[model samples]
Target chain A: MLRRLIARWQGIVLALIGIVATVWLALTDQLSLYIHPGTSWFAIVMALIGAVLVIAAFALTPLEDDHQVASDASQPGPAVHLHEHDPTAPRSVGSGTIRAALAAAIIVGASLALLVLPPATLTSAAAAQRSINSETSTLDQDATALVGGDTSSFTVKDWAVLLGQSPDADFFAGRSIDLVGFVSSSPDDPDNVFYVTRFVVTHCAIDAQPVGVPVYLPGWAERFEPDQWVTASGAIVPNPGSSSAEPLLLTPDEISVTDQPEQPYVY
Target chain B: MSPPPAPLRPAPPKPSTRPRAAVGLSLGVALVLLFVAIRVLAPEAVGDVLSNSVQDFFTLSISVVIESLPFVFLGILLSIGVQVWLPDGFLLRHLPRNRVARRVTVSLLGVLLPVCECGNVPLARGLILRGLTVGESMTFLLAAPILNPVTIITTYQAFGWSDGILVSRILGGFVIANLIGWIYSRHPSPMSLLTPKFQASCAHAHDEVRASRTRRSVAMFDKETSAMLPALFVGSAVAGLIQVAVSRDVLVTLGQNPVLSVFALMALAFVVAICSNVDAFFILAFGSTFMPGAIVAFLVFGPMIDVKMLALMRTTFTAKTLVQLTVIVGLASAALGLAVNALA
Candidate 1:
């Protein structure tokens, strides 16, 4: 009887672990950091469905033939390693027992890893590893989708795309821009020059690409911190040293720290 | 089921008297206690050491599962719906069987299935079970992920609809999937290619074979969930780990070398395993750095084969078959990518 109960509930226990991991993500409001806002509902729905499946398994075990559930409980092997779909194919020689244990181990390891870790957005180090374009003054208009219709709605990406499209460096001289992103900087940059970066995601966090622009807060540069969320209101100007380069320079008039936005990553 | 190798089919065993329950219960209890103790006592130390890259890795891994599971669910729902709800013979009767006509029709039929590469495995398994020939089904499996509306429009948009990438992707992907299907159709011992369990279970009634409508579907949902979820996590964890350890910037340096770049980007594509519908956005970041051919290869090779596809494919195919699929896909994408590189 004890053997019958274990075989039947093992799948449910695994499913329960999946549910727990998702719930942990949800409770911490960290799902947003992992996926786009539009698709977060699916995770919730999957959690609910996963719960239903676990519950159904619990109910079905008593009615099911004990031999039947035990077979399934033990069959996670070939299903993963060599799914013998053809009836005419030869019988599996490997132990189903071993495969089942492997499946259990993988699922448990993955779930625990996520549940135990702290939730975080990509770091400045990764932003560097991604090597996002820092100079956004001049951009290739033809290359990007052109998100904003006019100068007032310009994002960090729009400014980056403006590099090649501009007739010349003077084109952005007096353009006033307002933008919000987490503060980031190059590894060796001084206090005055730091980047304001936002991740642009086409699908999910896995594909999010960082788009950032260099901001020069001359007098107040030393007061800021990396990865600090802030709003910068500034006028665009060409960089003094690299006048011939296309990267636009931002000279901020007012800068203030802000709470991380509800939808922190751009879609 | 059928004495092992049954991922989905749950049939009666002869029964064992060993107390498997005690092992399971003890393990569960131990796992909970250990996790609680470690998480409560040592979280800060773990966080200080593992928070940055490790956290990103965890996020990437979980997000991959989060993104793909919905499509997997929908695919399973649709595939099993056809199996359980459709009166027998309905599918085989409606689907074309003329060699050329059937392959072409089914190949083009992929436009309707929106699921990407990771989620298409279960659906393809269903199609085969419904009597579609290996050739026809393989064509659909390969083409469906790329030819669908979501992938097409996204690719177009990602390229900013310039440089003929949209047309080239369509033309190139269409040709590759069809050719592979055509080639496989020539030598094919379809039965031997498949695992024996699937072949046997295909004839027999498994657990959900007789339940009522709701029960049947729910049972199927339970069965497929058990079968596929473990593989999804395994694949995602592998993919996430690779992404964290290898930086995208490192891959960017190889883009300067044209010949090596294609292979580099191809390997990157296989490792990243981003969905075809959204890979264009990811690859677009490489636009300024990588050549056109490398870009095309990344797009074309990735959707057809990747870490997720490899992990998922093992559930149904032999190692030999997977190797063949990989070599054929790699060579074809390389040829296409090089052709585009030469043109550029």
Candidate 2:
């Protein structure tokens, strides 16, 4: 019994250290950046449960003598019986020493890396912000161009920025901006209207979410398939208190089929 | 007999002479104390680092464990129930007799079990002990994470039905699993890697329960769970650390360089060791930058070959076998990815 207990002692100690370290780190707020901000509380709870399970398992394991006898009785072969009581057999000693050293090295290395490395700089975030700001400014200058006047002042980014800033922004409620995305058919609206969809990816394409602006182009139905990526220059118009889908709609001036851009999704 | 002269032999000491349990308990306590002391006495500069690290560790641990709790619990319960309730002859009776038919059936069945890659290890182990052939067990291990309902639903939702990515992932996973299983069956030497001692232990546990008419199976379940859970926690902790510490920029940069990208992602998959349940999301995010084929390779190869899986694999197979399996899975996944890219 004693021998069996000793054999499992190392595992038990390691597990406890792991549990304590995890809990301590979480409670001290170090774990916040990696996990979803919203899920921090839940994470703590689960950690506690996991820790308890681990500790309980460690405590419940049978003593070494009983374990050894049980094992010996179960397997009669010499192969199974060799050095049964030697917990520090050469194979175990070498492997254990190496594994422990490697684990310590990894933990230390990771800690140093995390400490030295800065948080990922959001390169796209800055660009997106700049583009939106620029577009918004242009749209403001082109406010008068909506009355059948030609305006080169407004840029695509400004219009997007304006639309995003106020889905109810008054000027764009009846004006148009150029947009590009894949065609997605709406089941309810069987007219020539389709959603021009693009994915906005943040970190990677994996977390990409679909964003679509509704468009009503006269010949759009015949021009594009559901998955075909296309670009359309259009006029923005407000929907008259219709469905909850989207308040504003687009009226395309010209539609053209386009190839999917590299990095099609943005987070 | 009493008249015979007594030999001058020394009798072996009784088992009571060894203070085994006490020594073990003290050693365990001493190690814990030693670690705690070292943690407490960390240098001031490193103290801040350790504190931050601990916090990060806790947070990541919690998030991952909670995120996976539902699936983990369900998988364990199902596994336990399968062990206790499923008849001994269930697989043998239901599984097809022909090799080809068995392969197909096993592959199809693998899709229905919604276990993450880590969870699949235990399930695979259980299936093997329950008398499933190596080929069937291998097929299940490879296909379970890829073909499960959760992965399918997630994929459908991610890509929609616009292109055939969803169908392609399924078809690709199915074909690859079966092909690997068939090849494995042809050369069954890998099956010998399962240590006889481990098999005997598993069999003994099973036999004990079978011998008892009462609810003694709970004890066996507890024993197995206890044995497996510590390794699981440690392995996962290591994986989490790698995920946080490694930069994606490095991976992306490496991924830009031709064939190196494929090997890089495969290596990254082994290192980052994300759960199979949500790895596809990460893979999709890296689209276009890395070859679609390479990304597919990452997805297929990663779940089966991560650090945690390797650790678990060590428990079952010899070192030689583990290395061979790793190479085989790596090559197979890459080939499949290339094939898909060419055909698509």
lDDT for every model?
Answer: 0.67, 0.53
Top of the candidates by TM-score: 1
Per-prediction TM-score of chain B? 0.83, 0.76
lDDT minimum window of 10 residues, candidate 2 chain A: A121-130
Candidate 1 has a TM-score of 0.78
Interface RMSD of 1: 6.8
lDDT string, candidate 1, B1-344, tens digits: 11112223334422421233334334455555554454444364455566567777777887787777767766776777766788877877877777777777777766877777766887777777777766667788888888899898888877855656777778888888888788888864875555444443343333345456655555555555655677778888899888888877667789867788899899999988998988887787556677888888998899999998888777666677789989998999999888888887
DockQ of each: 0.26, 0.05
The lDDT leader among the candidates is 1
List clash counts for every candidate, in order.
15, 29
Model 1, total clashes: 15
Q: What is the lDDT of residue A124 in candidate 1?
A: 60
Candidate 2: stretches off by over 4 Å: A1-3, A9-267, B1-76, B188-191, B195-197, B203-206, B210-227, B237-246, B254-261
TM-score for the first chain in candidate 1 comes to 0.68
